[model samples]
Target: MPCRPSFSSGFDGTSDQDAAMEAADPRGSESDGTWEELRLLKPREVRHLIWEQVPLVDASSSQEYLRHHLPGALHLPHGARLQQLRNVLPDLSQPLILYSNAQNRAAALARRLSNLDYANVYVLGGGIGILLALQDA
Candidate 1:
């Protein structure tokens, strides 16, 4: 069998309206009791954006980050550190991209950032694993 790439969207299980609902109130995107957009990006897209954006964030553990991370990726530990991250980051409006080792931590983190009024938060589809798989291939 030929090797094929598989992917999942952060919005796979919900309607756009549902996602919008999630953005309402304190669901996800409502730092100031409002809503924002969560942009989903492919690994390749993130790779390209890294050069100009400098907003790549790795939300994995310190060990995983030390082992591997995209070039110029800043480490934020995880979703809980987002508040402190606000202090560390100079511009909240800067295009922020997030990724994790596996699963959908990137998506979760992206939503959390959206809730915190980040105007440009993006989740890396398939996170770092897809990058590794594509890199190996």
Candidate 2:
């Protein structure tokens, strides 16, 4: 039988855990007190954009994030403070791409980032599932 990966809520020295902890913000992307029309990108475009080294922020739950995420993606939990995000992504003008299992979380993060004056914040339309499906195909 093939060996199954063990799951742990605590960090266990794995790359995924490292990535999750590196980008974790317990406060999450809460209401920025403003809303804006989110810029949406198709999965194909996002896939290509990854080659350019644009940071992909996964706004999914930690459990979902541990299960899977895009290569080099950062995990951003809900309710994280804007200041925390600034620490992770210092450049306000840099383009940021966010995704989640459901579009709501990603959209919320995008709005928060945009309200914080992130020059280019976009949400992955249809979420990570679509992107992963495209990858599989």
Candidate 3:
């Protein structure tokens, strides 16, 4: 007789209970290569982080940034003087969250920061609209 696959078996051959346990746990990837602990936070969480003094860098253009932005967010428009970044943000180790109206600009700035050896850099998902909504809420 041929052996048959069990209903509880996952792609990696782990049982459903094992996968569930891994998903419930928070540490790192399980057999599926999915992050166990990572989660996309809401705008309120971003706001709370900002209020807690986390450094935020707005990668939008000067006009856009000046029009409206998080009260204390540092404006570092992409392709501006990189030296300005060094001057304004002397501590490269700080938790820096970069954001813009869209993902391209923010991702570009994040890449630049990463190349410049910023250790704790992150890009905000959903951008300013999310933050605005959170504020409205």
70-136 per-residue lDDT for model 1 (tens digits): 7667788764667677887857788888888862567677778777778788776555766665445
Collision pairs in model 1 = 29-115, 30-115
Residues 97-121 of candidate 3 have per-residue lDDT tens digits of 7778753477677777777887777
TM-score of 1: 0.63
lDDT of each: 0.63, 0.70, 0.61
Candidate 1 overall Cα lDDT vs. reference? 0.63
lDDT of 2 at 125: 67
In candidate 3, which residue ranges exceed 4 Å CA deviation? 1-41
Q: Write the per-residue lDDT of candidate 2 for residues 16-121, one digit (tens) a residue.
A: 3223422432223436533336676765567557766788888999899999877677789798666877998999999999999866799889878877899899
After superposition, which runs of candidate 1 have C-alpha atoms over 4 Å from their true positions?
Answer: 1-37
Q: Candidate 3 at 50: error in angstroms?
A: 0.8
Q: Which ten residues in a row have the lowest lDDT in candidate 3?
A: 2-11
Off by over 4 Å in 2: 1-36
Ranking the candidates on lDDT from highest down gives 2, 1, 3
**Higher-lDDT candidate among 1 and 3?**
1
